[model samples]
Target: MCNLIGHALQQALTRRGFIAGSAVGASLIAPMMCSAVAGDDELDTRIEIAQSSGDTASSRTRLLLLGTAGGPTWWPNSDQCGISSAVAVGDAYYLVDCGEGVGKRLQQALLPANSRVMSANLRALFLTHLHSDHTVDYPNLLLFGLFTGLDRPASPLKVFGPGRRGQVAPVFSLPGSSSPTAPIISPDNPTPGTKDMTGYIYQAFATDLNDRMRDNGKRSLEALVEVHDIDIPQIAGFKSPNETPAPPMEPFRVFEDDRVRVSAILVAHAPVWPAFAYRFDSEDGSIVFSGDTARSENLIKLAKGADILVHEVIVTRWIHGLFPAPRSVAEEGLMQHLLGAHTPVEEVGGIAEAAGVKKLVLSHIVPGNATREQLSPAGKGFSGELVIGRDLMQIGTGQAAAPARKG
Candidate 1:
């Protein structure tokens, strides 16, 4: 049995193109060999033990959950806020989604407010999809950042998100008509891509932006913001506006700088085509954000061997309790839409397990006040460390210290 196991290990290393003489190859092979010999159950047990002991290596990257509520609305008395998060590497911060009140949350996180420090350090913004809940505070982030700190940003603020989806005909057209005469309508008109959307924001705030520039002697906010529309490479059953296919199952590098590299993959968020999950890789470690999705295999491929998986999770059973029983057809449809788009807590664990992430942090939590008993369903199959996210909670990328809970 020992000899057979050794043979299998040798074959696996060879298949992976690992050189026997290379120290890096040997380091990689050692873990695989142990896993193969101990088997999955033993390996999982070891992982659980290590997690329980808080065995995490120290690194420079940090994740802060600015808000953890699943939807756009924030309750008056609840501690939960709308969805937004920031991943900081060294002194630079990258924002993912800008839900309502994110600016205040940033202030609460000790990020410089109305200061030059904020302008210089708040590096870039990444939008997972164009949901209102994810983008409600975009204008605030863009405008507020200018005056909250010392001075306006010297460089253009970078924004990235998936390109617009192609227009589709309305479900209901004029009865007995072969073609609908009225122009095709969507949730938003012109199906503006991210670039266009950025421009529109600039135009919408032109008067105020100009006043800030001329009156306050500030830089042109319009000129200082640059937007990039991510043209999601087409995959089977996932079509982008361009209709061109990229290499299958490969992560697309969307942004890179001296501090970190950002890669994205198309995730399954049906009826909202071209939704993306982003992975940020820095010197400390890699962190992946699932934005909002439902059982996306591409996300698993993108997140393989990642240090932390910050995924959006919802408990469908609790969803009904949040709203009155679907009395109207529209209400029922809304519930169905919610059910179809978000990932269940249990499925979130399975995705983390499949990706082999070290820590699973659940954010954008549905029914914000979910109890431990309510969330236990997610732990049924996952053995890695699990963190129930809350607003202003800071998680270090490397060391497995207890998350610093603030606010």
Candidate 2:
């Protein structure tokens, strides 16, 4: 039955064309990529249902596994190239990187009820960096939030990330596109970067807001969407090649309300400078979401002893083996970037061990095409509890508030 189920799941994954370039030795490898039934619409309904039942806890410190696989470049099917990102539930809704399909995933997980993520409430979007796969949904989230009524004048939202004026503006508000161009995001510093993507995201939404309000009855687009730029690299540290001049790292505190507190630090995801990892500490427990990074001591320092370290992982051996011969030089060349850009399974374990974290949630799993053995490399290296995350999988941190243990 397990084999049959695996076969079925493999078929579903292949139909989506999310397969990798390598050929698998067995059907078992195929099952790793299963169909995630809960799309954004579905999640939205669930949240609405949960809220209507007076279940505020549903929107509490719960972590919703929205998009687990990375880099397929499309939606759930686009698993190959995308990096991992997630939605964290707190007093207000907080989005980890808005990767590909994240808007839809958020839509599926939010909306419908009079909850915090309804038509006009947003906690903030915490970003690790500006990788295309990790940030593809930036424009979508901004546009959808406004279109779906989630973003309105009264419900200004926020987007946080490392600042890069040249890279962010194009995506935040496309040049010559109908969207409103924002004031340069990132802020003044000796490092030379923007405030954050918030301003640019809002500027992009401006044109959409005008069209929506003029077309519909909604008034005041600015009220609906608000942007708070966070200079990540300045506070954290920018990773760059030693031979080249490195952009100064900027890491800073984003928010610290009674409900949750967020802090960031820079990590090494070279060539692509100014990457980050965020630590969201709440009363119940804490979670550290690594944006997209190779191995880094900096990340371990930031995540020390946290309940969950939501980090990205890749199969180093399998990736290297895929193009092992002289004939596959081109393929090997391509793998180098991915291999070097992401953390290997053993590295994840090492990071967890060094940080003294009790649990590790491996996400943004790369080459979603690897065998089960290859896919779950982190499990073998770490003795502490480890989770090979799947979309929609929820990890609980605090003990289910129970009656006091009878002493």
Candidate 3:
């Protein structure tokens, strides 16, 4: 009787294209079926629903997840891209990071890609750190914005991030190389901060910028971008790479406009000092982004009373399961680095609890394409609204606080 019931159910699902010949086939078919059901109109409706729930759609701030994968490497046939997000307030948008493939993702989010209004509305980009995964699309975003009709920003496009870390020890030595114990080489001066990096990027694109200006009558890209290097107060135990120590870890304002006021705090993503977590406050509500960090009290404090706390998370269980038990020295070292730099999923709940945040949205998720069952272990302690972030998910920041919906 059980076999007969199972067969009937399978047949029903197969007819609906939600399943195929076997369970393995079903897994593939299910997503396709879901895509078919949720067409572009459905996606727009989802966004509209979230936007319309509050006092007025125009007054509410919307959070859009552009990418949700954890690391720099994008696996073949993966649904998500790297970690990036956008906060939309009224007509303008503020990007959080420019992870891999962010330009395409942004085009999808802001439809009618050639619309001058849409392109120009991309006001500022705030970077949490200088990790390759997070900044992979920096060039793409900077160049493509012009082609998309972003002529001149209201103000120079502002980019904010932590200052550079001084030279540090190398993580690993090349295989078969002599002097494996040699320390990493460092220049006489400290590492370049965000402002210097921005200048470098501009200079790197000098030829392109020049040609575009002369041929297309375009303005200089350098005239459009401005970078700010945040110097947060050093935590008692922590040291910054700057020659002079930073002031303190208090909530310091980074940017402000009529729509939102942004503040930042230093979070611990060691070996990469001066990592930041940002808080955005508007009349509607507040949202905190816990950029990339391990367990951090500073992050908790920054997120305190926030309407939404978007935190990065890693599941150690899944990570361990990815490799065989008798690990090599290199594998062990990699594991140690990952474990130390990222927040464990189990601890995420505690941080949310301590912060008293209303909603916890997990992004930069390690082991991309993780299922809810796999992520459940992380939510053991806290009971606030938990959301497993996905690319193109949109959430409304308002008193009504509509549940996040896939875009």
- By lDDT, highest first, what's the ranking? 3, 1, 2
- Model 2, 380: alpha-carbon shift in Å? 2.8
TM per prediction: 0.76, 0.68, 0.79
| Model 1: per-residue Cα lDDT at residue 244 | 24
Per-residue lDDT of 273-363 in model 3, one digit per residue for the tens?
Answer: 6678899998789889999998888888889999889999998887788666787767876777688879888898888889998878888
Provide the clashing-pair count of each candidate structure: 9, 37, 2
Q: Sorted by TM-score, highest first, which candidate order results?
A: 3, 1, 2
What does the lDDT come to for candidate 2? 0.56
Pick the winner on TM-score between candidates 2 and 3.
Answer: 3
Best by TM-score: 3
Model 1, stretches more than 4 Å misplaced? 1-59, 112-116, 149-154, 168-188, 234-248, 322-327, 399-407
Candidate 1 local lDDT, 215-236, one digit each (tens):
9888876667778898665456
lDDT of 2 by residue, 77-134 (tens): 4333244354344435677876666755454444323223442445677666666777
